[model samples]
Target: MKRTTIHISAALALLLGLAACTQDEAGFLPEGAEGTPIVFTATGLNPAATAAAGTRAPVDGNWEGVSLVGVLIGGTVKAYDVTPTTADNTSATLTSTDPHYWTNHDDITVTAWWPYTEGETTPPAVVVRADQSSPTDFEGSDFISAENQPVSYGNPTLRFTHRTARVTVVLTDYTEGMASVKLTGLSTENGNPAEIAPYDKGGDTYTALVAPQSVATGTAFITCAFTNGKVFVYKMKEATDWQAGEEYTYTVSLAAAKDPGYTVSEDGKTYEVYNAEGLKNIAELVNEEWKLGINITLTADIDLKGIDWTPIGKDNNKAYTGTFDGGGKTITGLTVTGSNKYAGLFGRIGSGGTVKNVVLEGVQITSDNSSGYASGVAGNSWGTIENCSVSGSVSGSFSVGGVVGYQFGGSITGCSSSASVKGTQRAGGVAGTTNSGATLTACYATGDVTVENDGTSYAWAGGIVGTNGGNSILACYAAGNVSGKGSGTIYVGGVVGENYATVTACYWSGLPDNDNGGATKVDGTNVTWQTAVAAMNAALSGKGWQYELKDGNSLPALKKEQ
Candidate 1:
């Protein structure tokens, strides 16, 4: 929020050196243009904002050193101290928690060096105002707001007009929360703009075009809706020349979550509309990530069989319907895995949805290649998980929980884990890491969470969770052995790795062991394994339930030991 006006060599040189120069110098400013501020104005059917790590603008554009001071969204005015990327050329750019900036959505103005102007000794600024002259406003609505559109094939198709362009963004295996609707633009020459698309493809990636004539040369905007009603902007430059009647191919690929719209059958079993007939199996699951509506009560314990289920994440091509309840069923003896990320009950259960009475056993999960935050129950939980258990290993780089990893704001109640969580970094028992707005309750762990060998030792491994954001953890415990030291640092705890969340009536007793380069000593106070087992039995008895410790047994008992 504070601006530091520094007299850098460029600024000082431009001010002092230009003063001594005459109009004869080529790089010198034009005599009459000295007082006129070099101002830039942009207007178009701005696309909805997209995640920065994903796509840029529909046309090729960059905001390398542009200054964006403000952005306007739904009539609300916000301010920004730094620059925002406006590359998509769609409508508005969607902002993510990453990059940390782009969350504000008011008018953007900056005082940095102009993006395209080379050696121009003038200050640059961007000004935006709603086009009152245009009758039809695609300003507030996302792209897929229109119905009965055409389906896409492998690539995105484009249609052009003098003032507008329509692109049908095609994405295969579009899942819940993992939809891909990215179209950015950049100026081919000096006067162009960059932005992220601003429309929603109704969770499907389709073609949407931008009127390059309506946008500047190097600005992009994403016109999609994010969770917190914020607009993310980017700076882009025209990368190619798109002439009228000339067709050029632009590929936009994103890794998003899957959308599962499961319905209950007459036989009390839940079934998903598997896939469209004749659709090539590019992904294991179609649409975005699978989400449940309410609680999916499973009266019977069923096997998932040998189905290669789909994975999902929190991207454009991901979707979730409601809560998926296993209804006290033993969800075991099956092999399920996804490409992006997958949850047991729902992909993203919002800040509601309670997942209880389920057991995830003998499940094998592969690691997410790029963005981490994969979990056994859900990707990034914001609800309550109770009376559940997980017994499989999860591998990813960041944001992983045994029962639930990367909780934003939720509760993990009465759950336990006996799985091995392996990741390149940031691994935890209950949650890999948590924000300051989450709560954990009545949870325990006995897993061996470790980090793989990497060059640097900067890992954040722990027993319960790698880190916590001020929440409540009542009657919870952890006993996992945290290890790995290649670029990893031990933050292990008997109950939690780092407890910003409250731990009441909880304790830890797992053996603290580490391998080479790891801190051999455990981080928490000694609670002893026997005490931990007794506490587990006592909690189960009080709840009229039973539990089994990780003692060598082919078939673990469910009843509490006498």
Candidate 2:
């Protein structure tokens, strides 16, 4: 329960809402409405500034979490503060709550410098120097690095409040000498009406005292209000905090996050936070043995460096979320290798999030022994995936797929796969087996899929789905060579092996050969290619997927529900 700061903007929300409404309009044009920019100023600690001694002691008051409030910057103690300026719509400040140097009764002045820019292209580089004793000269300085390279300090990273129009002080380093960390600078912005509740963490207890509900009557977005009426807004990107307190009560304020760039890797088992530039790929900063939950956003291209997934045990359940804009750059040349039955990049994805503009390429697997399921990006998919692709080889004795081995609901849209897949029983190019209702739209598969004889009865296996218990396959196409043999019964198709549910607007040109088959093998009842195409084409009628058929569109349009 750390004291974290998050900001929201009224204008941004309105714009986004408008965009969403016009997304489906035939002639909708994207409005080039740019955002506003803001300037930041640093507040310092005065020499004669005095406070109640041992007032907000670390182990005294009801604490929430750990935070880095004060730091020794350029031989002086500096107080962290966020100031406002004009052009407040476009820019933001970057700060963190990671551990920093702080001491009580220390005379440190936080000075504001202009045009903080880095010279190095790599990250983890030493940027600015924050020293001790005084803010005038650099004594003991800490360099901020990006991509493991020394870079110049860039722009000031600050958060603006949109609702309350108030500047929130994210207490990074706190001491007992300051009596208590207090936040000031408020304006009028109507936010949700709520009350402060009490909670306890360690041995201390505290209440989250928000501004009185009667503060304003209009809609209030969180904003950082400066001395004047300068207002800027920001949004919180995470769920946890590291402030030093038992229970942190947020009163409609913003919180700083752990800077992903220029972070010290605590251990080899947990994930590493690289400087902004050092984030090469998803594999560079993560591990399989440790469970450290981290949220991040990348401003540059990230390299995965060909890493495989770690097994899912009690020790590893780390969840990662955030935005990674590749600047229209492609995320490729990566591999996720595994041998066990339940091994995958996201072994257990319990959270509902997005991983886009990514490629799971050249995935090679050997072992087929799995008690549950496995896939390239995830073992079990219960979320959504968009604008992604996979190219790999999978061979297992049980359930397997190019994208996911098992899916229990959720959606996969704007994605494709081109991997050679093999499995003992349930096998598919996109999904091996599905238990819950899921949708795969505008997704195509072009892999050689096969199912082996495991000396047991087999049921479902197809180019798109092994068995279609109750999943919908829309605007999807498959061109894979499928071959399988079953004792009790077997179902194989160009799109799906067995269809107990619906298969709409999908096309399958997978011809059964001398080794495989010509069409679907359903309990010895086979459907010819003409029949399959007719049924699939019939389902396309008015759906956007009509183009997936012979004389229709090439790709499917995104559905409202999906």
Candidate 3:
């Protein structure tokens, strides 16, 4: 690392008169301020001590036609040619035909790079050489204006550090017949200098500018060529955070490539080897393992028909605490016909869990237990669900919904459900019940909610939520027909059967069919189908909701759903 100082000052009152009279078309300082020059003093510990002698030498007289310094002001950068004033090349003055100067009060940033073009403002990509004989060298530094204090006469110093890291791969204890090896999986392109490193090859070792962040956990491919004309492929696992100006080395032994066998192509020109077992299916994942804090990406849409399905987190006490990224894939033909208490793909979602980018299509979930929960996604949720949708049928005895049976505490955003929900006690198109700490935003439901109960049992059905216990519901709407049939007190509403929560910017359309004997009411705005659509569009658009008009649909659906 090296440190430098840049001095910018205005002359005394005597020179102000001259500066005011020298204003130019390029927006230089006024005439009287002309003599006040911006000076740059280079001073710092050498960054590359082991490099060649002239590598860290200052670019003084040699920088005549090159951009030695760049001044960034108001989001625009202006390069300036440098003219050394001293013999040591420690101090230099900026020279420009248009008098390129900045005011002392103007906040600006300065960057210094070697071998830069005359008018180039953006950093150039450091070229990478695949051959071990040739290698490219690149470096850059930046200084912000606010970090340094401005003086009327003195210069404010700045520090510069190497913006790239080095990585080396060592082959240890290799077989005698191994002739060649190649590594892949490292990123080779990045525009942000601080986040990603440009690729550079140096034979067995690679040196490049890499982002100072944690490297994602994955397998790196290693292809080896043998002297006997046989080729073998191996995968080396790597996980670490690469630091700037730091060197990392990885050692791999050839004996680690244990496998069933390698497959040969019909052409006999290529040999393919399987690294590890492929991703497990939904049923296999539920029966064999539980993933916590790990990300599960579904590679393809799953069909769970005619399979003995056990809900995740049901057999084991451990709840789902990892992230399930469906990658816009749907799980269709899901049939849960058990008498379990919690019946869904996920029995319960614990805190810090996330389920996103998934859709449950044509699912048929039913719980025969007298007091149980069933839904298309999760039976009970205390985590986050985003950009998810459900379209199916869910039936249970107690709590049942299209998306979630019970939202204990968490957030549900950009989600919708069109699954018909039926329950003996509590049923809703979106959620059967939501706690006070739960938040629902940009969610909607269009499925009909029905509550079938005996004369003595209580029934509640709603378009969105059967019961809201002081939860926050924002930017949500429902158009489902809610119905309740029972002798006991039945509550039915267009939006919520029982409201004891905060509902904002929510609307409901289509009145409930049968309202039985209970103190039930629609909490949000109740309007006709057309008026509800218009009002919802206006309100949601004002709140920056991304929506699109579907063919033959009165209201716009969320862009994420589409």
Q: Which candidate has the highest TM-score of all? A: 3
User: For model 1, what is the error of residue 555's alpha carbon versus the real structure, in angstroms, after optimal superposition?
Assistant: 14
Give candidates' CA RMSD values in order: 28.6, 31.0, 28.4
**Candidate 1 residue-wise lDDT at 335:** 44
Q: In model 3, which range of ten residues has the least summed lDDT?
A: 140-149
Error of 1 at 533 (Å): 6.3
Question: Distance from true position, residue 299, model 2, in Å?
Answer: 5.2
Which model scores highest in lDDT?
Answer: 3
Whole-model lDDT for model 2 versus the true structure?
0.45
lDDT (10s digit) by residue, model 2, range 438-516:
7776666788788776566664567877766556776566777787764655666777766656666565656452212
lDDT of 3 by residue, 458-490 (tens): 778878788776367776777778888767888
TM-scores of the models, in the given order?
0.42, 0.42, 0.47
How does model 1 fare in lDDT? 0.47
Higher-lDDT candidate among 1 and 3?
Answer: 3
Rank the models by TM-score, top first: 3, 1, 2
Clashes (backbone N, CA, C under 3 Å), per candidate, total 158, 95, 14
- Report the C-alpha displacement of residue 313, candidate 3, in angstroms: 2.2
